[model samples]
Structure formats: structure tokens, C-alpha cells
Target: MSSKLANPSSDRGRVGMRGLRASGAAAALSVGLLVMTGCGSSDSAASSSSSASSSAGGEHSEDLKLPAGWKHAVGTTDFQGIHAETKLPTTVTDATGASVTVTDDSKIISAGDGISSTLEALGLKDKIYAASKDSTSPAGKDAPEHFEYTKQTGTEGLLALDGTLFIGDNTKRHGSVAQQFRDAGTPAVVVDDQATQSEKLQAVADYVGAHDAGVKLVDSVEKDMAKAKDTVKDHGLQGHSVIQITATGAGGANSVAGTGTPGTEMIESLGMTSVGAESGLRGLSREFSNEGILASDPDVIVMAESDYQKWGGEDGVWEAFPTLKETKAGKAGKIIVMPDAQIRYSSPEIGAGAQALARAISEN
Candidate 1:
């Protein structure tokens, strides 16, 4: 293994909201569709890899129509799995095709994606050494190192840590460099199981040797999600109309949390309607006009806390879409912001995300 590791970053540099919309998130959404559509067979990955196609959200009983070639990529109630223990120095294979042998799990560093929260849910938070500075999850709150992982992670900095094992998000972001970490002698594991929550948790458990913990975490997730929905329903927020807008989107609220993406699922779990899904979008999201927002006329709108801050908060939203002031959400000051992890990835922490989202909209 070389002491120096090649940077896994591309010339484009830290992928931004727009860049991911063009590539990475699209990759993740299709993988999610595989799971949501019951493509859980051993060969589902092969089917997902063949093309980016949307499937109906089979898990949801609603008549919601997913964006074409996109499927519901978040929010689930199922939580059943076989329990197992792992032997030390186990070799795990990443979806990106790299097989890693993990000898230690003490000094873990995450790209600060949803997997960071998943690690915390797995009771491995103390093992995390560093994470993304932009992370809003509890796992990164006391992290020793807060790196600048904006979208996709860079592999070059990880080599210097001399950590025993590395975990990354391949289905959504930071997936292209599994081999790079392998060359550096650190066992690199990517959360590549995208078809189902059970499969996803087990893959991560196998890599970190925490099978029992992973199984328990699933039941916890189910309970938490159920509780979140019940809480929101108690508030009489069910059937509420809402739309999620990304700060990077133009025309203020034009960037949508469209059908089949985590944002839409989060919205639904909170007992709200996703205008993005109702509009019959073709992919995860697409730019819409202010006129479209006026037509949907949602009761409230939401944005990611990270993106909101990056864009400069209230003033930013107003400036991005001057016409938004005319919309119902804007007029009533019902615009809300939630953490990035809560609205982005579908993982074991989805229940927490749902709970957080429930609070955000309920309070607003």
C-alpha cells in the first residue's frame, strides 16, 4: 500500500447541488427505486445498474405518482432481518466493486453524509474521528475533525489518517473511489445496498462487524418512524399541502423535492403532500417556474438548513425568487428549513429524520 493516495475528486471539485442533480443523486435515486419497487432479488443491483428508471412506490399505499424512472427513495415501515455476528478481519465488498478487509473499526471517519448518522444509530458514534463540517447530525456534533466534505468526498485526505477502516456513501454520493482507499491499505466500505433497509443495514453491519447492533437498530427505526407519524397526526397535520424547495434552485422555490427522492418521502412522512410528486415529474427533480408554484399553492414550503445558510437565509430565499412573496407560503411566512441529512438520504436514521421533519412543520 502506498503512503500517498490519489484524490478521488474530479476536476469539477466538490460537487454542488446542480452537479449532483446532473449525476450523483440521479444514480442514487435509481438505486432507491430498485428497493422501493420490490426489486429485492439478488440480481436487483444488476437491474438497477442497467438503466435509471423510475418505479411505482410500492411501499406507499397512496396513489402518488413517482417521477418517471424515479421511485420513492426514502421512508419505510418494514424492519425485519436475520441476526448474525462477524469474525474479525472480515472482508466486505462495496457496491462500487472493491472488496476490503477490515482489521479495526476504532478510528472511523465519514464523509459526513447520511451514513454518519447511520453509524451513530449503530452505536458506533465514539468510533467516528471526523466528519463533514456541514453535518447537522448528532454523530458529527463532537467529531474531532470536521473536514470540508461538500457533496462527494475526496479520498486523498483520508490516506493520511492511517485509519483501519473507511466508510462512504456510494449509492448517493462519494462512491467512485473505493479502489483508491483500498490502495492505501484501509478497508473501505461503501453503503451500497440501496434496494431495502434490511439489505442496507446488513451490508454496513458486515463491514463494521456490528450485525447484532444493526438488527436492533432496524426495530428502533420502525418504532421511531411510527412515533413520528403518530405525533404529526395528533397535531392534525395529516393531509396538509406542502412543497420542499432546494436553496440552490432558481426562482426561489423552483427547485423541487420531486417524486422518488428522499425529500418527497420526508414530506409525506410528515403527513403532507409533495407537490413534486403530485405534479408528475419525470426524475428526482426539475426546475419549475414561479407560475408552477403559484398553481400548486402549497400551505408551507421547506428547505435544507445547510443550503439555506449557504444561500443566506431569509434574505437569500427572498432574493432568489422575488415572486415568492406572492405565494401562500411566502405571504404567511410559512417557509421552513430542516437539516440536510433529514431531507437527503434514506438510511437507518430515516426515523430520526422523519421525527425532526415532523417537529419542523408542526412548529411552523
Candidate 2:
């Protein structure tokens, strides 16, 4: 676990999408505006992989003390190949209320890891041409091309992939590109930045022609949540306070999850309190502050593995922010760490993320 820490693939989007987007950057793995946007003949065969792709390098273990019902995320999310689309050229109304008729599920680009990871849970991992880089996760870890959600770029990257459709998160880049990708023959289906986890899952699933898979994926999320919360309640750990802290990359901008964000929802749903939420930091995501942390004095301090490493782990965090020593979590040494991808991306992995977090809390 110590050896596998990769810097976060992208910054924790400060915007409404929760670190999935960068100011103007593009995260084009593959997507296109097809029939609705007059898509050109794009030798879609060029984009399809002949065989199923596996994680790049190899699967890195987080060494999580997973709860009873949860399995390791890699092979388990494939749904046993249950893709249930009935027709081609299906019309999908994306998060933006725009319609796109997808012609090829064989060639797809997940503009963000949210879509990539969600699609992987839907058993469509083989169809993904690329995914966000450094997404050490339940899925998209092996997506050959490193997808980036920061720094807006031109359509050269999009056109090169020759993908049939692009699934993106609603962000500055995703929103501003409605017609850019369309004009490039890439029909983009942007998922709402603020959609619930299930809605986000259903959006990408629908775009990729996996409505049935989407339902199952959503159900898995719900069941996982129920199990996770039960574990917390069973362990007598409900309402424990937590604050997930993440850096931009190694030693980058420090941020904390607040109210209305996936991190908070996951925490509260598991019957715990988010320090940021308790303090009324309503930005959904907000800057990390030593004074604020001391004020709320959470029960546990959650950190992304990369940030944990950057700060030289628990001992280092205590030294750098000596103020942490005054907090309840610090006095008890309840510092926690998890994979960056699970906590950062609001995809199917979130439930698994919560379960892992729950397991950690029960231990604490």
C-alpha cells in the first residue's frame, strides 16, 4: 500500500463538480456528436478494442479492511457482462437536457473518471477508449490513455481517438464545449455536476446504452450504502465526526469536503458528521484551515493516500499542523487514509469508498 501511492489524477475540482474539472482543461478519452450533430463517418472500428482491457501495469492493493459484504472493486464491478441495450441509434437526453443518438457503444470516451468508473461498474470497461489519468480506482486504472479534466485544450485530442460518443461531467470544460465537440463530430453527453450518485450513474449508463446495467449499478450503490450504514450502527459508531482532507496533488492546495458534496453525503449517510458541514462551511468543497479544523475538532481525520504520503503520513501531519494536536482526532491518533480515486470521483466507487471508510471507523 505504501508503495502504490500515485499523485491524484486531477485536482479536487473546487467548482460544483467536486474536483472533477480544472479551470478550462479537457479530459477527452473519446466521445462524439453523432447523428443529431451530423457526425461524419469515423471508421468507428478504429476506436474499438479487439479484446477486453485490464488495469494498466497491475492492480494496486489499498490493503483495506473491507467490511463483510463488500468485495475488492476490480473484477467484481463487471456485472458478469449484462449489457441490455435493445437498439442502435438510441436517443439519450443527457444531464444538460440535450439529446444525442449514440450509434456505437464499441467506441466510447469517458471525458471524466466519473463516467469511466461508472461505466466500468456497468460492465462496459472494454468500450472505454481512455480514462482520467492516475485514477487509481475500482475501475479505469488501466485505461491506456490518461484522461485529464484540467486545462482546456482543442479538439485535436478528441478527433484523434475517432470515438463515437463522449461522456463528460458538467464543468467549465464540459459546459463550454457543447458545440465544439458537436462540430467535431463528437456528440458530448454531459452529466449534471450536481446530480446524485445514482443520477450520475444513470446518466453515463444511459449515454452508453446500458439503462438496465445502470439500474443494477444504482441498486448496488444503494445496497452498499445500507450495508455500510448498518455496519456503522452495528459497531456503535454512528454520528462520529470526520473530515476528508485532500491536496491538489503532492503538497498542493489543501481542501476539505463540506455540505452538499458527495463526501459529506457519504459521511452523513454512514451516520457520521462532517466537520466542514458542522462548521457550516457550505461551499460543498472548501479550503482546508487549521483554525477551522481546531474549532470543529472532528473525531477522525480522513486523507487521500497521496496527501497522506505528501505530508509524510500521520506523524508528519501532526508536525506540520501542530494545531491538529489539539483536536480530538489527533489526540486519539485516528488519522485515516484511503485511495485517492475512491473518495474523489462521485461514481459507483463511492459506495465502496464509504464501506472502506466505515471499516476504518469501526477499527478506530
Candidate 3:
């Protein structure tokens, strides 16, 4: 697989729901609110200030105020739009230098991953510019108005970026955006929405200024996975299998199943078995299947939470597949409803998604 296949889509999804344009969101993460405030819509026309320093020569590291338990890692990278130098941790050491452990690999990017959350964590939320290109979630169709604001502002050049995070399938429409960043000297971390296990999470770390961020994310995932494994044992879900079907393209109501989809990944991550990697159901009515109205014969069924509600939740899925209620997963009450926000393309959120899946599988 291409490296791009393992990366998240544009950083837009990281803040797509809460607001923040494409490049702007990333720029927000890269540059910070100090430069982005009031610059999203009607340009503020303020003269450039030099508050941000480059990661070169460790200048960025000097300004950071990390969490009480956090410390600088071996390496550093520019974070947010501020180009503030940030470092990741070298070891999972706590204050006592004992290694911290993480279990699951369900990836998640909270508001804390990009500009919006970083600023808030650091007490700079009020300085956010809130401008962004159009963004649309599975729950909310139609991309928002500020979809490509980062590209519009030439953020790629200003921050001197090296990588980006993408959430969905690679399309020319959005691929061009990645290309734009690449052309401007930045690599991208792309992930498909159908990706259930979020194995591609490391791509986000590739862009994080600190190697410690990668370590932290990975450790967190490991801890979550371990917890999931325990949950599976507690629930006796061993040797179970599952599948995920998805519809791609505009209104092309057809269905197909694949190993790449999120639901399948979720099953495998929990140590459950699955059908052939290439095996899947395809070609259903995009109108409904896209919302998960279609059914598959798996031990468990999982769908985006928003789509679950759209499909009428458990009642709707049961009505659509009477057999589902009879299946091991279903009878055992294993239907999973994922948070729509977790479905988007953010690095930090990948861990959160993994945790959710672990919880779903272990609990069910």
C-alpha cells in the first residue's frame, strides 16, 4: 500500500465539526491563534508579527508549557499555526520515570490534536480565527463553507509544514489539496473513513513535531488494545468474525464489503476472526446503504453512530435484518454505534476511536 493510504485525509476533519477551515485548521495547529485570529473571513489586514519561531535550533521548544506530567522528547516539530516548537516524549515515563502503558489501537483525534484544542489547552481559545473551508460529516451532509481556507491563506508556505492528516478516501477533488501542500513542501497523512481499526494512526505522528507524540499515541493505543483483549475474554467473544460494507461515489446505490472498511478493522483489532481480506458485499442503493441500511452476516454489526440514528438505531437494523437479531453478536447484543465525530480524520482522535471500539466489543 502507498504511504498515503495509511495517512489521515486533510486536517480538515480534525476540526471539521467544531469549525476551522482546511489549511486554516492545520495552520491553526501549525501556527496557533496568535496569527490566525480574525483572519478567516474578512482579512484582519494586520501586519505580520514575529511571535512564532522556527523549530530550527530548538527555538520552538523554548516557549512550550507542556502538561504537568509531560516532558520534552528527543526530537521537536513545529505545532499549530504558531510554528511553536514542540517535542514528543522519548519514553512513556511519568514523573517517577516509570513506563506508562496503553492498550487499544482505535485511533482518535480530539479537539486537542489540532489548532483549536491546542490553543484551548494552553488558554488561547479566544484567539482562534474560526475560519475554514467547507466541511461535512456523515451526520451533516454538504461540506461547510470554509473547506479550503488554509490553502486560500497560503498556510503551507508560512508554517513550513512537512506533513498533513486526511480522513476519507483519496479523491482528486481532495487529493489536489494534498498535492497543493506537497507542492508547497509538506507530506500528508491520509486515512479512509471506512478504516475501522485506524492502523494508519502513525501517519499523524509523522507530522507531529515530537517523536514523543508518536510514542504517546502508540502507547495509548496499546493500552486501549490490552483493555479490549481483556474485555473480549470477559465477554467470551473469541473466535468470532465480522465484516463491513460501504458505498462510495455520488448516489451510486451499490454495496460492497472489504477488509479496508472501518467495521472489519474494528473486529480484527479486538482479536476476533473475519472472512477473507478481499471478501465483501457491494453495490447497494447509495441513498440508504451509505447510511448503513444494508446488512451483512457477521457476528457483530457496527456503523457510524450518526448513520445508526439515521437508520433508526437498533430497531431499524433489526427491522432491516431480522436474522441480525438471531446472530451470535446480535443475540449477545453486540451491535455497535460509533460516535460520528470519531469517524472523521484527526490524528489524536484515532486513539479515541480505538478506545470506543474496544469498549463496544468488550462490553458487548
Candidate 2 C-alpha lDDT tens digits along 250-275: 22345566654566778888888776
Candidate 1 lDDT by residue in tens digits, 307-333: 555555455665655545566777776
Q: What TM-score does candidate 1 reach? A: 0.61
Say which candidate scores most in lDDT: 2
Worst 10 residues of 1 by lDDT: 27-36
Could you give candidate 3's per-residue lDDT for residues 168-244 as a string of tens digits? 23232234544444355433223333333323443233333334444544455456556656666777877665533
Kindly report which residue stretches of model 1 are placed more than 4 angstroms away from their true locations once superposed: 1-87, 97-99, 149-154, 192-203, 231-239, 248-255, 259-262, 269-271, 277-289, 304-312, 339-349, 352-364
Candidate 2 minimal-lDDT segment of 10 residues: 29-38
Ranking by lDDT: 2, 1, 3
**Error at 94, model 3, angstroms:** 32
Error of 2 at 81 (Å): 6.8
Worst 10 residues of 3 by lDDT: 28-37
In TM-score terms, which candidate is top? 2
TM-score of each: 0.61, 0.71, 0.45
| Angstrom error at residue 83, model 1 | 15
